[model samples]
Target: MSIQTELTEQLNRYSVDFIRFVDVSALPEEQNKGFPYAILFGIALTPEYIQEITNQPDYIQQKIKREAIHRDEFHLKERKTDRLADELADFLTQKGFTAYSQSEENLAQTGSYNEAIQQTSLPHKTIAHLAGMGWMGKHDLLVTPEYGSAVSMCTVLTDAPLETVLYSPEESMCGECQVCVDVCVPGALKGKTWNIKTSRDEIVDIAHCTTCLRCLVMCPWTQRYAQRPVAVR
Candidate 1:
């Protein structure tokens, strides 16, 4: 098998729900960090946890409880993605390509903020969107056909000339669905549709967002993902 195909098949063992290779040369140097290629991958959140969060009472006490669940799961899944990215980077390095894994720790140390774009360094969702794995949702989250926004993503950059699938940037598939906007208690969601030029702040106000995950839980696409059979997931 070709190296790309072999590595892709190996990702199953790493619990990757989706993976894509994309050329990021067009991105700003600050974002791509001079890497021409990026591996963008995501791991879907546990359906059971999502269901619990979605079905729980919205009272303050219950909201806090579900928030705790959301926080813990996010950290757990983020760590898993971080480790997977590091492993993939090492694998590519062994294959003679210079690779750099974008670890949470490294990003944290670098303070993550890209002042120009008003976002964190090398947004994983942007790469995922470029890879045709997803589109930016109304809530400013990457909404995938398979996992919706219920996924944790990470990135690995390399100089390797790996295979890629080119696609035009996707427009919002959200249509008139305003479930996320209506469910957002903090009024963070703007109910706006996203396009290539839309900035994240245009969809949601980060300052007002409580990170309570109400938007995520109420999303129709995410609900569909949560309803999928466990075995199939």
Candidate 2:
């Protein structure tokens, strides 16, 4: 079997639900730190838990908060992301390649305000999209066909000999829909549609985001129905 296929099997054993290898040669040499390829993996969220948001207002809010804990994978699962990344990195290294896994925790924290990327240790979502996993949602979160904005991602960058995919970043499907915009209690969402070039500030006010969970609850992908009632004028 090909190296990529073999690696997939190894990752699957670790509960990695999504896996993709991407070419990061075009990224700033420092961002990738000279790693030409990146391996991306994601853990899917439970759909049954996220579906609780469609209930009555009080029920929806309570369910969202309770489920958000699970959706974010607060305890064991949160640590699992890093653990799996390391395991994958080790697996790649054993194959005689220079591999390094990036911890999803504290992403950039680069201390640069002008650059959106400086906010995290690494843009795992960037790797996720480049890996053909999913696109960014209006909430500045990754949205996939299967899990919507409910999945968490981790990444590993390496100079491994495994194959790489041509970069075709996923496109946003938020379109003109404004459910996330309308329901945001903090009024953080600017209602702008996302694209490859869209930055967080261009659409949402990061400073104003209250983490209210409205956008998270209103997201159509997390619900059984993919559409929300258009906000009353």
Candidate 3:
């Protein structure tokens, strides 16, 4: 079996639900520019847990008050995401693929289309390009059909020469759905195009984003399972 196939199978054994490969070289072209690796996986989180966090009275109150608790909660969530990135990288590297986590510093340098797509010390956009995980949204975030703009992404860069999965570039799905823009407490998601820039020039503007997940959890498309009526046993 091909190495890519083997790797995909191995990742699946660990409960990784989706896997896709992208050629390292194909990423420099206009269609694939900015990234250098590709793979996408999601671990299912209970809908109840997601709803609890989003609907928590304290969570809503903190966001409304613009309190420090918002920062603390987001930091905790980010650390968990970072740990997942590390674990995935370790798994790939152990399998003899030269894999590493894409650095935050590298991400900062690759300014989204809202600004100019600047060159970073290490370009890692290939992962996003190859995974077919949706295009660069107007807000400079990766939007997926299943997750909308709600998914957390982590890159796995590898020397493994894997066959690439190609997907047609999708039009912005935020079409006329300004829930993200309208509900942004900090007014970060502004304009018809959903650009990510602020007057302060912060690339990501984490401070502005309370990570309230209002844009995420509140997304109509994100709660697909929640909409289904419970199956009475």
Candidate 4:
């Protein structure tokens, strides 16, 4: 079997919903040096959990294990992604390959898109798109046909000569779907379709985003499982 296939099978032992690797050598030399291939993986969030989150206040008022908690549930999932990425990086290192990993909570925020347009030092979103995991959404979030933006991403960079897939970027699936834009409480989303060249400002105004994450819940794909009536046992 190819090394890529073996690695994919190994990582599948973890709770991964998606996984892919892509060449990122075309990017700036500063953030990326010898590590050209980015190992991207994502975990799908609980549709019911996301559906319950109507806004920040809703998230804040959530009860977990019979106790009220704020953002704890969300951060818990981010930690899971980080843990798996760390393990995977270590696994690669043990095999005599150099690897570095990053997660949402453990981001290399040299800066943010809110600051300079190109300030994001290590953008996992860009890596994920290039890896063919999904397309950039008009909502300024990675949108996958299978799970929409309801998945948390983890990234790792390595220089190992592993077999990688030939990628043709996933095309935007939100054609004329203004649900995310229309439901955006703060009007952060631009309702514009996304392409490889679409800039952050063209799709989203970060300043206007309240981080309520209402747009995530508004994604049509997110509601796929939620729309079904509960099966009474």
lDDT pick, better of 1 and 2: 1
Least well predicted 10-residue stretch by lDDT in candidate 3:
194-203
Candidate 2 lDDT for residue 115: 53
Q: Write the per-residue lDDT of candidate 4 for residues 89-193, one digit (tens) a residue.
A: 887898888887775433444232324443456677888877777788778888876777888777888887765776887899888888889877778888889
TM-score of 4: 0.80
Off by over 4 Å in 3: 28-36, 57-81, 84-96, 103-126, 136-140, 194-207, 229-233
Best-performing candidate as measured by lDDT: 1
The order by descending lDDT is 1, 4, 2, 3
**Whole-model Cα lDDT per candidate?**
0.82, 0.71, 0.52, 0.74
List the candidates ranked by TM-score, beginning with the highest. Answer: 1, 4, 2, 3
Candidate with better lDDT, 1 vs 3: 1
Candidate 2 ranges beyond 4 A from true positions = 1-3, 53-76, 105-118, 225-233
User: Between 2 and 4, whose TM-score is larger?
Assistant: 4
What is the per-residue lDDT of model 3 for residues 1-233, given as tens digits with 9 covering 90 to 100? 77678667766675544465665555444523334555545443446645665567256556557866545444444444445556666777777776655535234444422224333432332255445666444344556665544454445566666677666645456666666556567876653443322222232344466556666555555556334466799
Global Cα lDDT for candidate 1: 0.82
Residue by residue across 99-136, what tens digits does model 1's lDDT show? 88887765666677554545676788889888988788
Q: Candidate 4, which ten residues in sequence have the lowest lDDT sum?
A: 105-114
How does candidate 3 score on lDDT? 0.52
The superposed Cα distance between candidate 1 and the true structure at residue 200, in angstroms, equals 1.3
> How well does candidate 4 score on lDDT at residue 61?
32
